[model samples]
Target: MSIRRAAIWSFASQYASFVIQFATSVIISRYYLLPADVGLFSIALAAAMVVAIFQDMGISRFVTGQPEMREEHLRDYAAVAVGLGWGIAALVAAGAVPLARFYGEAGLAKVMLIIAGSYALFPFSIVPSAMLTRALDFRRLFQANAGSALAGAVVAIATAANGAGPAALAWGMVAATLARLILVMAAYPVLPRRPASLEIVKPMLGFGGSSFVISLSGAVGMRCQDLIVGRMLGVSATGLFTRASALAGQLTTLMVGAINSVFYPAFAKKRDAGEDLAAPYLHLIACNTGITWAAAIGLALAAEPVVHLLYGPNWADVAPLLRWTALAELFFVAMPLQMDVPILLGRIKPLVWINLLDTFITVVILVVASFWGLEAAAIGRILTGAIWLAIYASYIPRLVGIRYSALGTAYLKSAAVALAAGAPLALSRWMSGAGAEMGFISLLGLSLAGVFCWLVALPLVRHPFWQELRLALSHMAKLRTTQA
Candidate 1:
């Protein structure tokens, strides 16, 4: 499949999954679930996810990224992957009760055990999914992910309606994982059956060992945002923070995350071809920042109305948190693919330290800020992001063989694109005054106008995203004409 086709498949899958998940969230939050319920589950899920990082073992990247792999290599990798997957499942299961007890919530244990069930099924999906991604066969990927989301959403709503409480969310994860596993295995049933030898496993472990540190900071650190808030504030506070951060994350994920899944292998291919990665890297930065920044800025400006619309008034506190987190997203995407770029460039050792420092800075900020209030923690996020960008400033360009000047120019154009995109909504908010309530129809209309302005401004600013967007449109038009 072509990159564009693969990306389209990815977006279709992501949006479908997001819609299901989003609808489920709205339903549960509005009617069924309480803030404390989500907070309890959020803490439990975060722990499982952090422990689940061990399953990475660099297996997917190893499989997808390598330019060459012998049959023996594949078999050894598969064997190692299976062993790691099962090990992580066991680890999560073992830690479940202890973690729950530590949190003083018995429900956390139940939620975690169900989460453990999902990880047990993860081994079955990992290799197959990676193989499909490497082949750019996103059709099967779409089937797996979309099916998983639908299954999960059904289970969540059904269980929540029946009063499963926090465990409902846990069951949703198990159902989702099972659905994904079935589809992925159906697509690629044959796995290398041979056992991995000591020498063969050595490199995988070494790479994974290094990778674990980066994942530790990036994945766990992000999740710890909730954990910290839950411990310091309360379950309700955690729920609000999780909702806010999740919203910010979901926006970026919905917009850019799907295509990013394709880029790992894409970048690997370019690397193997001995291409200078700077231009593609900058194009990626330009494209992603243009989309993510605008969406985030719009989210920030319209946080109150959006929170009211999707989550209802009970989640009103989430609005202010969302505002800061959304702007923090600007700095987060300022240096796109921080870990991935470093991983691809073989700068693992240095990346580890950078990530550690990144974690330290973020945690300290949150801890100190939490004393004031939820709003303080949220504001601290923006500072963390600014520091994040500064730490990455000197490293990324050098790794990608790009100069600072070129990076600055790309960022400038993307900033212009974001400002133009958000102009209408920002203007509307300003005119209506800070205390004004924006009705759904008005908010919707302004958002659409902002989108139109964004598109128009992209070409005006001579953005790389504009060229790519125009080309994509042209391609679609031609395809339609040919079919007709």
Candidate 2:
């Protein structure tokens, strides 16, 4: 499949998963689980994720980015992947006790133990999944992911309702991983062979070592807030922060995350073909910023009603947190393909340093702000995001020869669109009295108005995204006609 087609399929799959997961979160948070329950699970998952970074150890990227490889090479990578996966699983299981003791939560140990089981199954699927990705066979990928997400959602919801608490979340993840493994096996039934020579492992390790460090740093940066909140402020605060972060992430994931899954291979192909990446990269920035900015602005404007309606009164504090996170996400989506572009260009060293810098900055800010409270922590993220954008701006131009002026121009129309789109909701909130009680219907109506205004503003601003959208629709039409 073409890159565009692959991205479309990936987006559709992720969108479906997003909806299911969103609903599941609502049900579990509102009825089945307490804040502490969710918090405990979040903490356990966060710790497991730090260890889980080593599970794939860049093997998937190695497989996907290579122009060609023999069956032997594939088997070699697969064997190494399996070894890393089991090793990480063992590490996590062993660490569970100390992690739980440090956090002073006995349940976390159980949750971590349950989560560790999923790591062992990860190796079984990673190679096949990478092969599918390299071939642009996103349809099968979609099937695997969507099926697993559905299965996991069901398991999580059922178990949560049955009062399994955080264990439900852990077991649900295992189920998802198992389902994905089964589907991937069905899709690409290639068995891994043990490597006979050390040569295969050497080169992979060299590339993978840098990738692992980058992944580790990024994970730590992202999850450090959860650790700080859980340890310093307690589980309930961590739960609230996690919920807010998840809600804000939904918009970014919907807009850019799926496209990113396709972009790495796409960029690698371009690099292999000796094509200049500046034009495509700039276009991506414009389009991503346009859509994401509008969504972020809308979410921020409607934060109060959204939190209340979806998660009930107990989660009201999450609204402000969501609003701040939404703002940070705007900057994030501005450079959705940042890491992919550099990695594709074989410039992993600078990227690793940048990630380390980001992790250090994030942890420092989050730690200092944690003393104030959750809202302060949320605000610190926005500050960190702005600073990171500046940091990225300094390096990206030097690395890729893209002008900063071009990036600023790309953001201009989107910023205008966001401001215009958010005006109606802002007005509604003001007119209804800032503290006025509004029902779900009222909030829904205002949200519709905001969307309508956003659509109207698009053409008025002469946004480049409008043309892109038209071109996409035209392309889809032609594809349909050709298939017919």
How many clashing pairs per prediction, in order?
0, 0
lDDT of candidate 1 over 209-264, digit per residue (tens):
88888887887678888889989999999989999998998998998888788787
lDDT of 2 at 307: 86
lDDT score, candidate 1: 0.86
What TM-score quantifies how close candidate 2 is to the native fold? 0.96
RMSD of each: 1.5, 1.7
Candidate 2, RMSD to the unseen true structure = 1.7
